[model samples]
Target: HPKFDMVMHDLLVLLKPKFVVMDATFAMEGNGPNRGIVIPMNLILASSDLIAMDKLCCEIMGIDWTDINYLNFVDQHYQREEAEPQIIGEKIEDVTQKFLLPYDDLAVRAQRWVYKNYFLTRLCFGTPFLNMLQGCLNVYRKVDEEIMGKEWVNKYWDNSLPR
Candidate 1:
């Protein structure tokens, strides 16, 4: 029931893990992390700092950095916020490209409205239908690229599929 914007902050406060790694090789589009259309991206990102990794993930996902909750939380709590994380392996540009945002502007705005004005999140967490809907929306999320696309899918994606 948590919003995407808040996930990073929540993770930092709760988990405080030593490392964070993100696999965006086959990320989702449209509704995502659950129900969105999956796209072949071929990317792997890692960082010692959770905030940095989450920010990078948002960038690759085409999510506005300003709108992400965890990033904001980190900036407020951690010093040297702008310092870039050390890139131990592939650079971001080489491995990834911009993908579509999960939802249209209208839907996003509406969701934000519900979150801010209607106290919908409280209800959503308790209700089965809302929970299920959120689950479906996020169903395609956190999935392996291999599951979403074939080995050759990335090569032929642009030519064969709709953007």
Candidate 2:
């Protein structure tokens, strides 16, 4: 549990990716991946440095980058001698949009607790009936996609970003 963050950070470092291209256009906040409030942040971000890019993205998103685990892990492990990235387009102040964070609601908190708790995990997860949860989530995703993502999909097809 303790070294999990370090392990993940190490794995990313090991890959040594050349560049990062982030699509912040139609970013999601709150509970994400089909079910969330979508922010129409019409900007594409790119950087040769992943960590610097992430830090800049976090600033643009109006959140503290230090709060993120992998970023924090890197900060803790590596020296802070690296210089910040230079912005070529919109200033962070002009584009900053504060997004509502996910997993803060009671339901999510309870779900996280249940999944993390040993006894609850053994009782709840070690069952064939638990497969229904996936099915239910899939159904929810489809419904959400139809309701919310449909508009975005249509807009994307038409190349029309909502202003």
Candidate 3:
């Protein structure tokens, strides 16, 4: 996740998507998908400019874009010069909701572990250990889904949104 902004920056640089559409009808807060609360947002935003769209969405989620370093990098990469896009529809303030960002305790702890150095991370990815790790992740995700995900969807995700 630490490198996600960089990863996204590179991906956007290469693909240069013509448009990005976000479904804000029901979004996750707190620990995100692994373990997060659901909130109803009830809106869809689209744009040809990914950076602009992302910035607006960030604000809607009550997060400061400046705090996200990679976003700044990408903004600079696109030569945005920190100029915000003009929102086309509803006022951002009307729809804004303060989101609880992820803590990712497990990831943080794993990153701090002595054995999880860069070399070992790269090595693990290319070895059978990766499969074992993925298997464990699948089990963890499934348990979380069973314990929380399904119920959240049923309760917060409304039928009004696109299927």
Best by TM-score: 3
RMSD of 1: 11.4
Better of 1 and 2 by lDDT: 2
The runs of at least 3 residues in candidate 3 whose Cα sits more than 4 Å from the true structure, single-residue gaps closed, are 80-84, 112-116, 133-163
For residues 1-163, what per-residue lDDT tens digits would candidate 3 score against the true structure?
5477689888987897887898888999987676889999999998878888877888999999988777888877654334557677799899999998878497767765625577776667657888998999999999999999999989988869887
Please give the ranking of all candidate structures by TM-score, highest first, separated by commas.
3, 2, 1
> CA lDDT of 81 in candidate 3?
39
Model 2 over residues 1-163: C-alpha lDDT tens digits? 3356688677666886677899988889988875799889999999877788888888877789988887888877754347667889888889998988776678777767887777786666777656888889999999999999999888776666575
By summed lDDT, the worst window of 10 consecutive residues in model 1 runs over 1-10
lDDT of 1 by residue, 31-141 (tens): 766667888877777777866777777766667777855567667865544565677666656655566665556767876666785457667554686878877767655
Q: Give the TM-score of each candidate.
A: 0.54, 0.66, 0.70
- Candidate 2 global TM-score: 0.66
Q: What is the lDDT of residue 120 in candidate 2?
A: 80
Model 3: lDDT equals 0.81
| Among all candidates shown, the one with the greatest lDDT | 3
